[model samples]
Target: MAHQLDKSVPIPLYYQLKELILNDIKDGTLQVGDAIPVEKELSAIYGISRTTVRQAVAELVQEGWLYRVKSKGTFVKAPKIEQSFIQALGSFNDQIRDLGMTPRTEVLELEVIDVPGFVSDKLNIPLGSKVIYLHRRRFADNEPIVMVKTYLPYNKCKFVIERDFVKESLYPVLGESLETQIRKIRRYIEAVESEKYDFDYLNMEKGKAVQRFISIGFNYRDEPIEYSIARYRGDKNSFEIIITAT
Candidate 1:
């Protein structure tokens, strides 16, 4: 691979190297499965330290732009397609089905418990009220995707928490069993770093970037019914929203 460096530019050397490599990949100068240069060679060619080269490569690998084979070298990876949040209202299973992928869920924990203050407030219930806590590890094509924690009023849906959530969608259960229809939702998104619990559940590095979505769902009668907090891997996932003016 041939690269040109601008030593006079104010940009950091590692970032410059990263950009050059990314551009080559994007412009088809480097095709998928092409082996990238080794760190020492890259450093020598760029007149920078091997540490800088490694840093750049590490970032690319984490972002899914590259993959490293155990005994071989690093190779270019196919880019992931971004998901459009503006499309429609659907469950994770439904969304993945629309994309022609199989969505699976691993039930991590499901239990009825006393609602905490925050959860109670979000669900518009009194503190210490009974709520079903549903925790799941969501996957796409068997690859871990996101971790979700959902809270629902236990009194409204008595037997839902006892069912196998890994094989069912909570939305359907709520609609069929409790006769609750989610008519509207409020959501917020923010960037967060993986913490200890996330490391255990999502198999992510402790400090890696994640996308946090906090949502509250309402029923037809204008009553809050569901509160959920979900975290998705930033490197592997993205969301898009469309705005329409009145």
Candidate 2:
């Protein structure tokens, strides 16, 4: 659909044009993989310069709404690759399994290590205290989706650090081996750009966005027992929160 910009308005031409294109995608008038009008055509129809069209399209591409193919035109991106992330804070393995997808784990590092200061503070242990650290790569349908680093006080989960995590998930292992239950957890989530490990494991572009989740978990006694940092592929995951007003 052609959108006319009122030159009389104060809005920047490129930005105004961008909203028009964005609306089309949001409304599904531009379906996934659908090619948008070429720059020349858009410029002529919108009464804007080709330069303005290029700028608008560049922003859309960077924002994950559109993608370009060499020697071809730009097309709407596929629907965001996302999964169910609810406020209940279920394990990723459980969530993925319930979705009928294969959830695989690659045990990158599973052993006790001297705790970093940040981890020590979160788990309420002394700095340099030994902690069971588990570095794992989590996948769905064989596609890497998250990198997880979990720190547990050595006294709390030392028995778990030596198990074969490649065949089992950490939460389940904790329950079976230590009879530990997760009573509560606090999570801080934020958007971030891909780090080096994300690039290597998730096959994401270095500048692409990721969702970082920092969690501190407590046991039945309400004592903090675990601290973990998990980074999920932003393009592949989203979260939902259900609220009830008191």
Candidate 3:
């Protein structure tokens, strides 16, 4: 592990150590599952106290960047997956796997409800038409990362609700069941402060910053098939768009 620590810097020693470890992992100097030196060894090498080393290691473990096994020692964790906004065709499951974290979903609620005017407009369906409402919470390594609300026409995809959504991605199921192709998607994003309901499900503090995304997915026939609204934790997420000029 390589890190440049300035003793004169105002930052605390533990935080400095934490950043060094994190940077080493991010830069590929430390590979996943690579064992780190024990606390006493690290302290001796850095000329710091064991308490400082322990604090840095503890924080890293909490953030999923490191794992500690009893009597085994600390090991670097796999990096989080990166999702490119440049490609509209992307899967959240694949993104999570790239990040070296397990992606788990909890289907909080699912039911058929009358389409509201906003949803009807987005889905291009008649108002009051039956729609399948899917409410779910997505987790990354057991940390709640997003809350999603998705709507689909009930008549077209009634069987979709019967499948296990917890382990499935909605896009693939829609394709298989409806014989539909997700030709394109439109997305919008904005920053918002967390609300009471967000706090309840996401276990986030009210007034915390969050990123809200609205997506409309269309089929090959240029017909809208899915409308979804999702909120992600600002602290844990970043969206990148790649632009190429011709």
Candidate 4:
């Protein structure tokens, strides 16, 4: 879709152009792996200057919605895996589906156990409290993307152990099956390098960068019920958040 530039808008021309391309990506007009029209073509069609087009394209590239290949041109990239902390709550499978990727989970381990002191504190539970633990490897289009370790209060969600996580997503099970509705979540993100978790479950190479997502979820009664740690392949995912003035 092409349209003449609007000079009256407060936004910069290139930023407006960026949203146009991004809309195409989101609306399926530009499917993953499809080559975007060259800058010259876009400039001629939109009646915008080439420099403006370039600026828009550059921003898209940096934001991971498009990738450029030398001598070939730019192409629509697989949508980046994003977690909108600002919006506050979404399941991993749901997030992957939002990106139009097939999400699959492989159950690695499920059991009940006691966690270390710091972990117990983070979960807001007393030491020695039994927690139901789940270790899973997640894939997008059959490529290993993240390894997750989830701990839930056994007293609250022991039924989770009997359910098949590969078929029933954990977050949904917590709400629909266990009656543990998640109302709030506190999240922390950090960068890390490949570790044992990656070697055992993820297909990431040695020294490859990873992004660690640590989250503690609370139920409707403001009781902490879950603590989860997910390590995502940094090269395969991107996390976006919006911050506003208070």
**lDDT of all predictions, in order shown?**
0.84, 0.84, 0.84, 0.84
- For candidate 3, the per-residue lDDT at 210 reads 84
Candidate 3 lDDT over 107-211, as tens digits, reads: 999998999888998988898699999999998888888899999888777888788988898888888844455778899889999998788888887677888
Identify the superior model by TM-score, candidate 2 or candidate 4. Answer: 2
Which digits, one per residue and each the tens of the lDDT, describe model 4 over residues 57-166?
99999878999999999999876566554355777778778778888999989998987676788877899889888999999888888888888988889888899989
Candidate 1: worst-modelled 10 consecutive residues by lDDT: 80-89
| Model 2 weakest lDDT span, ten residues long | 78-87
TM-score rank order = 1, 2, 3, 4
Higher-TM-score candidate among 1 and 4?
1
- Which residue runs of candidate 4 sit more than 4 Å off their true CA positions? 1-79, 177-179
Q: Summarize candidate 2's per-residue lDDT along 99-145 as a digit string, tens digits.
A: 77889999888788999988888988888689998999998889888
lDDT tens digits by residue: candidate 1, 76-172: 9977636664245578898878778899999988999999898988898998689989999998778787899999888886678678888898887
Candidate 2 TM-score over all chains jointly = 0.72
